[model samples]
Target: MINDDAQTRPLFNKIALIGVGLIGGSFALSLKKARAVEHVVGLDRHSTSLKAALQLGIIDSFTDDMASAIADADLIVIATPVAQTTKILSSIYPYLQSNTIVTDVGSTKADVVLAARTSLQEKVSQFIPAHPIAGREKNGPEAAIDDLYVGKKVVITLLAENADQSIELVAQAWRLCGAIIHHLSPKEHDQVFASVSHLPHLLAYALVDDIAAKPHADRLFQYAASGFRDFTRIAGSSPEMWRDISLANRTAILEELDSYSAKLQQLRASLEASDSVALEAIYSRAQTARVNWITAIEAAESQNKDGGD
Candidate 1:
C-alpha cells in the first residue's frame, strides 16, 4: 500500500515527456493536477502537436530538440509511437542525466526493453518499461484527456537490477493519475499484453478491413451501429502506431491470433451446421466472462479507493 502522505511528495523535479500525443498529453495533465512534478516539458517532432500541447497547458514548456528537452529532467517519459522508440532512445541517450528515471507508454515491452538495454545499458537501471492499459481509439493531442489513465491498469516492466526508488516513483506517478500498478518482467509483460491488448487490436483491424474490402463497403458501412462501432472502434487508431506494435510483438500476437482464429472457425462451423446448442453455449460463456470481468473491475476500484484513503 502507498502511504497517503507520500502522495503529497513531489515525484520529480523536472519531467520531460517526448511525443505529446494522447498518452503524453494525458500524463502532463495528470501531473499538473496532482502537482507531481515541478516542471513538465513536452517534446515532439510535429510542431503542431507541440503548439497544441502548449495551448492546452499540458506542459510548462515545449521543444523539438530531444536533448534540450531531456537535459535536466529528473524523470523522462518516451511517449512516442513504438517504432520510434529505438531511434528516440538513441537521440536522447547522450543527454540523459545519471540519476534520471526514464520510462515509456509504448504498447509493447520486449522490443522497447531490448532497445534500451542495447543502446542505453548504462541508463538501463533507470529505464523502466511501462504501458498504461488505457486509451481511446482517437489519436493526437486533441484526443487527450486528463483522466485518460484514471482507474486503468499500468504495467511496469523492470530491469534485473532496477533501482527501487525509480520503480516506486513511477508507480507513484501512475497512482496519482488513478491507476492500479502491476509489476511484470519484460517477457511476461509481452506475453500477457500480446494476448489481452495486441491480439484484440489485430482482430479489430482485421474485422474492419474485411468489411471494408467488400464490394458494397460504402453501403454496408452506412448500416453500422453501436455494436459495429464499439467492436471496430480501435480500427480508427493511427495505422503507423499499430504497425509498429504489430511488428514489435509479432510472436506472441501471432500465437494468440492463431488460437483466436481456430476458435472463430469452430463457431462459424457450428453456425453453418445450425448447431444451436453449441452457439448458445459459446454465447453463454462469453456473457458469463464479461460479467465476471466487470465484477473484478469494480472490486479493484473499491480497493484502490480504500488504499488511497
Candidate 2:
C-alpha cells in the first residue's frame, strides 16, 4: 500500500529525468503539480533541449554529467527513445544508488527489459519498466503539459529482480501524476502496442510517404482535406524517434503488418469483384467497433471525473 501521507508529503526528494522532452517534461510538470517531488534534474545530450527545459521550468536544473544529475535522486526516469535504453542504462549503472528507483517511459518493453538485464545485471531489481499511454503530436519541453497523464493509462512491466517496495514506490509516483496503472509482462506490452499504437503510426507514415513520392504530390497535398490531415497527422511526428521505435519492436510490428496486409487484400478483392455486400460487411463492423470503443472511453473518462470530484 502507498503511504497515506503521499497527499501531504513529497514521494521523492529528487527526480532525475534523463530526457526532457514531451514525456519526461510532462512527468516533471505533473509531479510538481501534485507536489510529489522536491527537485527535478534534467539531463539530455542536446544542450538546446536542456536550455528549453530549464527556461520552461520543466526541471529545477539541467546537467550534462550523468553522475551529478542522478546523484541522490530518489527516482531516475530514462525518458529517451527506446533504442537508447541500453546506452542510458549502462551509463547510469556505475552511478546508480541501491535505494534509488529507476523507471522508463519507453513504448516497447521487451527490448527494454532485455537491455536492463544486460546493462544492470544483478542490480536490475532497482529498475522498473513503464510506458505512459499518453502524448501529443508535438515534441520537446515546450509541448509538455501538467495534465497530459491525468486520466491516462500507464503500463508497468515488472522485472523478476524487482522488490515489492521498489515497485510500489514507482507506482505511487505515477499515481500522484494522476495516471491509472496497468500491469503486463514485457512480451504482452510489446505485442499489444505493436498492433494498436505502433502499426497505426507506421500506416500513417507509409500513406503520407506514398503520396509525397508521387509526381502530383503538390497538387494532391493542395487538395488534401480533413480526412487526409487526420489520418496522416501522426506522420508529422519525429521520424528519428519513430524509426527507433519501429526497429526496436520490429518482430511484433512485422506480425501486425502481415495481418493488416491480409485485411487490405480482402478489401482489394471485394472492390475488384464489386462485392458491395462484402465491403459493407467489413466497413460496418469497423464502424461499429470504433464507435463502441470511443463510447467506452468517454464513459470511463466521465466516471473518473465524477470520482475525482
Prediction RMSDs, each to the true structure: 2.7, 1.5
Question: Against the unseen true structure, what C-alpha lDDT does each candidate score?
Answer: 0.86, 0.92
Model 2: per-residue lDDT, tens digit, 205-301?
9999899999999999999999988998888888888999999999999999999999999999999999999999999999999999999999999
Model 2 vs. true fold: TM: 0.97
lDDT for 18 (candidate 2): 93
Error of 2 at 135 (Å): 0.9
Tell me which residue pairs clash in candidate 1. Answer: none
Candidate 2 runs further than 4 Å off: 1-8
TM-score winner? 2
Q: Please provide, for model 1 over 202-257, each residue's C-alpha lDDT reduced to its tens digit, 9 standing for 90 to 100.
A: 88998899988999999999999999988988888889998999999999989998
User: In model 1, which regions exceed 4 Å deviation?
Assistant: 1-9, 302-309
Please provide the root mean square deviation of candidate 1 (C-alpha atoms, Å): 2.7
lDDT comparing candidate 1 with the true structure: 0.86
